[model samples]
Target: MRIAFYGSSLLSSYWNGAATYYRGLLSQLAKRGHQITFYEPDAFDRQQHRDIDPPDWCTVKVYPATDEGVRSVIAEAALADVVVKASGVGVYDDVLLLGLQEAARPGAIRMFCDVDAPATLAELRAHHDHPMHRVLPELDLVITYGGGPPVISAYEGFGAPLCVPIYNALDPETHHPVPPDDRFRADLSFLGNRLPDREARVDTFFLDAAARLPERSFLIGGNGWETKAMPANVRHIGHVYTRDHNAFNTSSMAVLNIARDSMASVGYSPATRVFEACGAGACLITDSWVGLEMFLKENEEVLVARDGVEVAEHIRTLTPERAREIGEAGRARILKEHTYERRGAELDRLLRNVAAAKRERSAA
Candidate 1:
């Protein structure tokens, strides 16, 4: 099958959240003998920090984010059996979104994959400020990377015909435990970009824990953190490349998972880092969430941190043997339940199903 992916930066994940998601999903789809022509806007820094170069197996076409872009994208999308207009492309043009909706006019199975389900839900619930409200009803299927219940309910409430949460899964070939690099080595490490909403949670769960444990080495990685000062004990490593992520996980005594306010509120959204970290056999200390047990066993595979006290105990008390056990269990869970191959298989089935449905409607 031919698939065209339009949304987010497919080539660059340097500081982008969806970069790994795009790379993993597309590469898996490619492995299944599907032809992919990924369309990314030229305006973003993705061109500057292209992570995975377009491989020989697929076509990666870059277009500008402009009036001309819509026409070009529409032209390219026509070649696909399925075209996915992914959410959070960092574009402000609703018209182009509408255009992508229309380009699926005759036969192609079009979809709006909402990676930011919690954010979309928050905005849609608001009903006025967000752009997604106007676009949801017309979309054929709304797919999400996170937000299991709250997101689906909200989308269906808004009159969406079908909505699904794909969730985040691992790609084992791409993510696995490796020797720790000196650059990422630390007692406890946190990697994520800063935003107005996420910063507070980071402070409550991460920074406060760092302050309480000045003796333990802590590290922070991600962009937009240059201005943020921390105790001298907390090492600010700026941005760690995606390639270095496994080493970062392996090097740490434990990796910290800080949920963005949106994901925490919605409860089912665990970031790619969560899977990536665990896949590397890293002991994880994360903020409490509702559906986390479905992924990791609390106080076993992962430590649950409700406050600075839990964080301190995870750092100060858990012995190496215990930590290794936790890491191994987490790794086992990821390998069994969430991997790129599994995700690819799931996606493969999904696309085939959606395609079949499209065919049935056409026949009808």
Candidate 2:
């Protein structure tokens, strides 16, 4: 199968949280003999700050963030066996969504892949005339990286024929345990770009905890936080590239996972960082959310906290030996159950089923 995916960016993680998710799933799909062509617009200086060179697994088509640029790519993408318009492309999303549907050849499977399903669903519900409402019924399938049952149910309610959730998983080859680097050494570290929905939570879950535990060292690695207020114990390292993520995870005694407001409220949504940190054997402390038990065992594989106070308590009492125990357990669990190899196989089956169903319908 040849898949043409229109997404944010695959070569860069700068201000784009979906890069790792794209690389993990698509690379594995390619390994299974699927041909992939990733189309990403050059915007937000992402092309300037690329973390990885063009990958061998896929052909990356970098287009300008202009009307003509998008049209050219859309024409090229229409030739593929599958055409996918992923959410949050950051430029001309509406044009791409409708354009792909019109431009795709007959018998080609059309899919809308949502990396942040919770937020997307909220927008669709709030606005009845949203483009997705019009696009959903026409799409062959709606796939999400997060939001387990809620997202599936919501998309179906919005008239989608089929909706599926493919949760985030570790790409062991890309993200695994590495020797701790001195530059990232800290008691607790968090890596996430600053955004409106997530900033408040970051302050509450991360910054407040740092203030409470004055003696503990904390690290923040992401863009748009250079001016953000923080405690003296906290250090801000702007935009840690994907290459340094292993060191960032391994150097920390523990890492944190803070969900955006929508994801936390919707529940069952796990960020890509969850698996990455665990894959590197870093003990994780995450904010409370529903359906987490479906992924990692509480206390054994991961530690859960309801608020900043609980976060402080966890850091205060967590022993070095215990952190190692939890970290090792977490890594083992992810390696056994949640990896890109498993996700790619599942996706391959889904795509095959969708194609078969289309053929059956056409024959009927």
Candidate 3:
């Protein structure tokens, strides 16, 4: 089937959180014989910061940020069997989304792929005038990256006939274990940008733990983190490239996960790093979330840390053998349930089922 993806960043994730996902999902779909064309707006320096190039499995097209971009996206998606509009690309993408919804011909499924569940719902509820308001019913399907149960209920509550989750998946070829370097080696490390909402959590979970473990070494790798003053022990290595993620994960005894404000509040989205860290065979330590266990076993595959004290306790007590055991368990679980191939297969089934139902309705 022909599928077109319109998302935040199709080939780049430099400052974007959705890159690894695009690469993994699209690549898997491509391998599965689904023709894919990823259309992204050349906005927010995204073109300049391309992290992973589109593989041979799919085509990548960049459109303008202006009104002209919609025409270009429509032209490319004219005959797609599926058309998806993903959230948070920073483009004035409402224009593009509305255009796709209008231009979609029969047989093509048009979707609103909401990566941030609670945030999207909040925006839609707070202001029905928001771009997504009128188009809720026009979409053929709605999918989210996270938000186990509550998310789907909320979207359905808003009148979506069909809603599903296309959770994050790992690409083992890219996110596997490797020898660590001194730069990223730490008792604990976190890699994420500075968002105002997530900053407080970072302070409470990561910085607080770093402060408590003043005698131990810590590392931070990501963009938008230069302005904050850090404890001398916390080494801030501005931005770690896609190439370095494995080394960073392998170096740390345990990698920390700090959920974005919306995800934490909604309670289900685990960052790609969680899967990547575990796929790379690195032990994971995540901030307490309502449904963390649904993704990975709590205190078994993943260590849940509610405060700085808990974070310190986990790190101090973890032995290398235990870390390896936990990492192996996580890797097995991800392969069984969280790899990109697995996610793509699930989506394939969902798409087929939806398509079948649509056909039956049309015949009636």
Best by TM-score: 2
Model 1: per-residue Cα lDDT at residue 52: 73
Write down the TM-score for model 2.
Answer: 0.99
Q: What's the true lDDT of residue 44 in model 3?
A: 81
Better of 2 and 3 by lDDT: 2
Ten residues in sequence with the least summed lDDT for candidate 2: 73-82
Backbone clash total, candidate 1: 3
Greater lDDT among 1 and 2 belongs to 2
What tens digits encode model 1's per-residue C-alpha lDDT throughout 1-364? 9888887677778657888887777788889989988887786577888667777766888887787776878776667788788877777356557777777646777778888888777767676755566667766677888888878888998867788877788888778989878988788999999988799988888888899998889999998889987888898887677778899899988999999888898898888999999889999999988799878899778999998778987899977788889999999988998777777788888888887987998899
Cα RMSDs, all models: 1.6, 0.7, 1.5
Write model 3 residue lDDT over 1-364, tens digit each, in one string: 8898888776777778888888888788787788988888888887887776766788888888877766877767778889888888687667776888877777778888887788889888899788676788777799888998899999888878889988887998889989887778898999998888788888888888888888988888888889898887888888677888999999988899989888987887888989999988889999988888778998678889887789888888888898889988988888777888888888888888888887888899
Model 2: per-residue Cα lDDT over 86-177, one tens digit each:
99999999999999999998899999999999889889989998888998999999989989888899999999999999889999998899
**In every candidate, how many clashes are there?**
3, 0, 1
Q: Against the hidden reference, what TM-scores do the models get?
A: 0.95, 0.99, 0.96
Q: Model 1 reaches what TM-score against the true structure?
A: 0.95
